[model samples]
Target: MSNNKRVRLSISQKIDLLDQNATGQLNQTDLGEWAMKKFNLDQPLAQQTISNILKNAETLYSNVNVVKNSKSLKTTRYPQLDDEVEKFVADMNNSNLPVNRDSILRYVRHIAQVKCRIPGKEISFSSGWLTKLFKRIGVRSRPMHGESASVDISSENIQNELRKIEELLEPYDPVDIMNFDETGLYYQQPPRRTICSESLGGLKKSKTRLTVGLLCNSDGSYKGHPVVIGQHKSPKCFKTRANLLSMTAIGKKHEVVYHYSTNAWMTNEIFTAYVKKLDVAFGRQNRRIALLLDNASVHKIKIPLNNIKLIFLPANTTSKLQALDAGIIANFKAHFRAQQYDRALCLYISKKLDNLDVYKMDQAQAMFFLANAWLKVNPETIKNCWQHTKILAFKEKTICDFEPVEYPTSALPLEEEIVAELNGMIPDLPGNFNNEVTDVSQLNLEADESDMIVCYTANTTNNEETAEG
Candidate 1:
């Protein structure tokens, strides 16, 4: 069978191609090779096809819509306004603020009245406009309830909580003030979007996950060993020494403490045991530290520790008040995802893997990468996240004083290298390469067990009893 395959280029890709062509850095043939590799085409793009695209480059550029990750070009009524609103919504979501129809409409009104003010002219934001805005931004209204719905995200309430945490943490040294939280890790998942045919786009995402608990000091000087929880105790990948050594060779020594539960989630028992272990460690060092915790039911401490003081943040306020939730965990996940791609690429280079279509990382492999990722998180990043919570005493700084920080993600150095190496070695890619992504704050929130399920075969259940206990 021929390895060559046909693919369709989206309007965005076409515009990007035009930009590269305009650079005059590559000839038609070379550009064809670049396009083949870039778009994951099985065969080199024909010279005539490039010429035709270049001929219609202006049309393609004009058709490119403001909607992000859109595979199709759209005719938007207000392109510039759409871009601004999308950016506003994204910033709101990234800051862990609620983004609902009311909030969006308020923003639209602000932009129309303040930013785009015109004498004797008023802009009406109709339901049709709101619907189109939501569609363009890929946002939908989801039901919110319980404590989350009742969360007082008002400025006064948030400031009061911040002041309260600041006061509680004031007496303790930065190193003695610590925050602990749990996050979900989808280790084997790929990116959510990919350059692919219509048939392959919008496929279901992988639900395989492990819960990771991270403890870090306020000063960013100390990152305690991670506590990992998974569905299985003795997974098949962990059955052999060789499998463990493979991960060790790729990353630093694995120091992660692993546990197992029925659903691989953080339970009251697991959290209490983990805390007790930390308390004992601190006691041995003669350290009396303040441990900050969220109001999760699992975070309840059944036993009192002599050396540890547990302070729980206000209900539904961890997103704004917890240091780790501010950005530390997101940065850690970025590093983890980057290492994930790095591991897959290394395997492919070693001929152990055939393609990048699907790279399955076992529990053992995930542990090593998890350790490495946590280790790679910068101390400054941790401090910055702590500052972000406004729970720490930080000097007033203007926005212009700091350059925007780029959190590490899978796309950063590895994606380009993988594409370049694969283009040279392999002529055909089996399937679309997904770049899995999700909300960083959502990872730290309590997981919905309904979406996650782990199944092991009879042969791989050897150490299940011992692991679970």
Candidate 2:
């Protein structure tokens, strides 16, 4: 008779077999017989092992406990490396430089080799290590394309300045308080992506842009017409007799006024003309008015006007303290882009139906679209923007109860659906086309040419002379 040798089962193998048998389809005797035949164990030994496994089955199934002490060499832990990386990150953030994955990896490798004195062969800063490092440091990497350099809005100096402005504004009526700012529009550029053919490599868009100045009262009761500045004194596109006549007629009908300059920028001369218009509109009113502006060179005009006061916001505080920057400009741009998208879709559909090869927009059309967008901005949006800059404090009582203004349907676009459809139809769309305009509204309450405002307390002669002069 051949001798049968018993097989020794490993702990993992034993656990696996026990787990399989734990289903309770077979009784203990049957399981023991099966183990004896399959694992080449003696009947008595199999029965004993099976009993022990069943008894300890609860502990085995409940916990994995996979980690085991090893006698082999282990990697060294560098606790100091974390502190060094944190310091490096702090220095990078403070330097106002872009911090991206590649830059971070390069920084870590440098530190590991030079600062930590780790030999090149021994140093390893894999992507996994970088990920873990970022997690431990509690920092996330993201695209911050247009974010302003960090400002200490809560600093003592900023608080004191805000307090001073608050005291200065206490006496003015909400209607008499206003924020003035300017923005630029790239009117011809459709959002980077639109319904287009995937086969096309790229689409080159027109670079034509226009600058606009916007003013609105703190209570949203009044919004000044947009003052549009364009590059051509008489654009060739508008030189046609019919086009010129149409432009003239449109200017007369709309609140938006068009101006021309070499660069389409708001110069002091153009700004002076705008202030004159503001003077005619609001300066004649008996009530004192306070206009908040940023410290832009163009806003420094010397021309004096009657019954108006200019308050220059603290330096670099425009992002935090300027009401227009808080949301008004952003809303305007969003509305403008939505209008453009609608126009493009309409034109595309019309061309397709007519079998036309192409469709394009002219300056006149862009200006009209801009005017319509300006009008579409909700009055409530303007009022809420003031709240961001604390211009309209929650505790302050207004002349009338705040009524919510209804936003037009045109201002609300189904952004996700529109974008997805556009991308599907036109895969060649530029990725960055929908980015908000980055033009800073460079405005200052102080005019370089004149004080722009005649003090309410000044002598009548001085006020009259300043206004007349």
Candidate 3:
């Protein structure tokens, strides 16, 4: 277990040793020279016994010892990370904290090159040793629930929407289905804490888990033809019908512009105005358009618009049927993470408050950082999106032989499902599952039921083996 006993050579030493016998077929004397070069030893260290040394090394340390641990058997007077990489690593350690190895590896990999000019900081070699070290330390960083948003969807509505979506699925044309919706765009960083473990430097805010809310599509970065929509991604005067209808992603087709609108945008005026234009744009006659929408108050609040069909989301369950929640949004975030190498598209957001204790500076700087990140997100290359949405089924009351519960009468109706219906539930190609997700069983249930036992069949998955072993 004590790696200190092993001989490990620096990359430079290995390269120098390999240089002598370019063919790597050396006689005993040459082997002695190679060993001397690799270990920086005095000549004649293994002068006549080069073969014995090589054989002994192979027997004791394995064949890879010649290359893998060329810098073996050297312990520094100060046993710390490289000086250049210290800032990147900061106080990460294995104290009372998780003793997390993978977290450490992630921290190391993320900040490796950013550490310094030295390449050793780039990545870890000696997979066996790193594995051993990680096993010894263990991962302290574990992901919990998304703390900010607390939205829920019911199983009953999930089933209904599944039925509706299935019926709608009868007529197939991916290009025909158009999804629309409005989400908030807050310029903020995810909460970070100092990693508080003995082995870790405690949770510190590095550019980690940066989450942003962007209204995009299953296929493209929600392109609102900034060329046409200008600065008003949403209208300044509380979003109007014309504002929603007029908004276009410079190059996108008007008919294909079906997206969702939110009551959060507020007002029957904007909702009505937008619906009218959308009606004229995709009249039932022009091309047979079915509007999918969530049961936001406005769709029902406004005196019903004739000719425009409104698909009401099940009471208290749009999150279940909604396409974006289970589909496009997941895909976008995945793309955002996969490319987080060499500081790709991620920003270092600092929460330095102004004298008034406002996060204005953080928001301003964060938006600026996100603007550049937008360029990196092409939103074209992704897969398996909406896999979560396809098999989605929500039922209010199970018949029998399954989990039972009291449905809340006060629960907000599963109203949001229609946003996709109002816009036409859009399907994405393999590419742009950027936000595509498998149905993440948010199953947010508080213990109102003492009688219910939430158990499942013995699925017999040994996934927890990694943790236990």
Candidate 4:
């Protein structure tokens, strides 16, 4: 003569029940009764329900991030297949292979047909299945490219190095712990491909490159002046305007430090000078910084400095350890490319440039765009990259909040009407435009034996010249 209602507990509530049951003070029936009363259920939970919850305690505990109202953990139809595919995706991604929705779909379909081999029936996977698979695997679509893929950094080694880094970084605030790294800037490279009026007009990839060194603190509150190294000490483009090559001309607004090398590569002398300047600047501000850098030969300079303690990452681990490589550089490149695209579109609109001419830019324009791009990189993006490296001391319970680095399609000339109007005109875009273009290439600035000898000879020559003077 009693009316009672069945109730499903949330994942969090189930975890609490498991914790209470773990005390070993109550039997299943007692625990069920206790849970019903504690959770204000209409009826005591069934003994079998309590037993099942306890049996899946580990799963419930792991799913604490599920929505508060979520009452069930749904199982996939093919858990084994899902697991294998997930692992495959992880392996491909770790190796830096291009794996996108189409690739994943092809992979899953191949597995189903060849491995599953269900008689007479073709297992079909839809967008829903792919979406679910990505959700279950806890990954999002990302554009991965560059030399980072070539470096195979072991997770175990990264963990060990992180532990050491954490201890060293403990004394400093997040805002005070800084990381610096350089990336090659293919400044003039256009999108690998773009919609044109005629058949796709692709151009040879631009080899015009500059090496840019970026530095930022863990909190991203402070961004150091970017160092832009190009092959020309005073490129012909800068000569058009007086004082154009000087940092003073670009002025305090951009705050970029311009340098030059024969090949636009970072060298020991350049890095030493850069750090010495930073050390002096920090000293002036009465600030002490624990600067994290990769163990590159160029970074091994013996610079007598105050207010800066240099912390080098373990060799070959920069791919996983360096903060800039995490996503900040990629983000910077995205912004830079967006601005580049904007310039092209503007020129095309103003009738100042024709199809292929739209992509053409002078070194001076490239420098201004690069400086603006550096300024445009979000501080939040910088902070997220630092956290993503996990070089800081913390148990990051959840996945990193960084969105996948993507080319800013908004800046691309992708307006349907515009693309439709230009349908047949041939515009030379960047080569390989089909694939995602992200710059994660942190070239090893380590000097080879020959390069080291050259650097040493150069330094000796410079010192002797100074002495003679």
TM-scores of all predicted structures: 0.53, 0.54, 0.35, 0.57
Best-performing candidate as measured by TM-score:
4
Angstrom error of the Cα, residue 198, model 2: value is: 11
* lDDT top scorer: 4
Q: Which run of 10 residues does model 3 get worst, by summed lDDT?
A: 223-232
Please provide, for model 3 over 417-455, each residue's C-alpha lDDT reduced to its tens digit, 9 standing for 90 to 100. Answer: 644453342333121133343322222334444322322
Task: Please list the residue runs of candidate 2 whose C-alpha ends up more than 4 Å from where it truly belongs after superposition.
Answer: 1-97, 107-150, 153-164, 190-206, 239-254, 283-287, 349-360, 391-469
Candidate 1 lDDT over 1-469, as tens digits, reads 9565655677677777888999999998998999989988878888888888888877677766545456556566556667778899789766757788878888887876676663324446778878877887677776542233235557687668766766666667778989999999988888775776565745456788999999998778999888889898777777675557355433345578788999999999988898888889999999889899998889887898988888888777887778888888888999998988887788878888766544577778778888889989898999888887766553233334588998756423336665566545432321111212122222212445442222123323544554687
Candidate 2 per-residue C-alpha lDDT over 1-469 given as tens digits, one digit per residue, 9 for 90 to 100: 7464544555455666686686878777787667667656675235666777778766655533321221112323664577787787789788877778788888777887778887787746888887767765667786552334666668899788877877787788788898888888888664564466575454566677899888888878888888889898766566554454364325554447779899899998998888877787775666678889988988888988786777888788887778888889988888888877776677677675332213346676677767777788898998887887664573365435578788675434447766566545443322222332222122232344333234222445555687799
Superposing all C-alpha atoms, what RMSD in Å does each candidate have to the true structure? 26.6, 28.0, 25.1, 29.8
Write model 4 residue lDDT over 414-441, tens digit each, in one string. 5676554444332322221323323312
User: Clashes in each model (backbone N, CA, C under 3 Å)?
Assistant: 6, 12, 87, 13
Point out the higher-scoring one by TM-score: 1 or 4: 4
Against the true structure, candidate 2 has what lDDT? 0.69
Each prediction's Cα lDDT score?
Answer: 0.74, 0.69, 0.40, 0.77
Q: Between candidates 2 and 3, name the one with more favorable lDDT.
A: 2
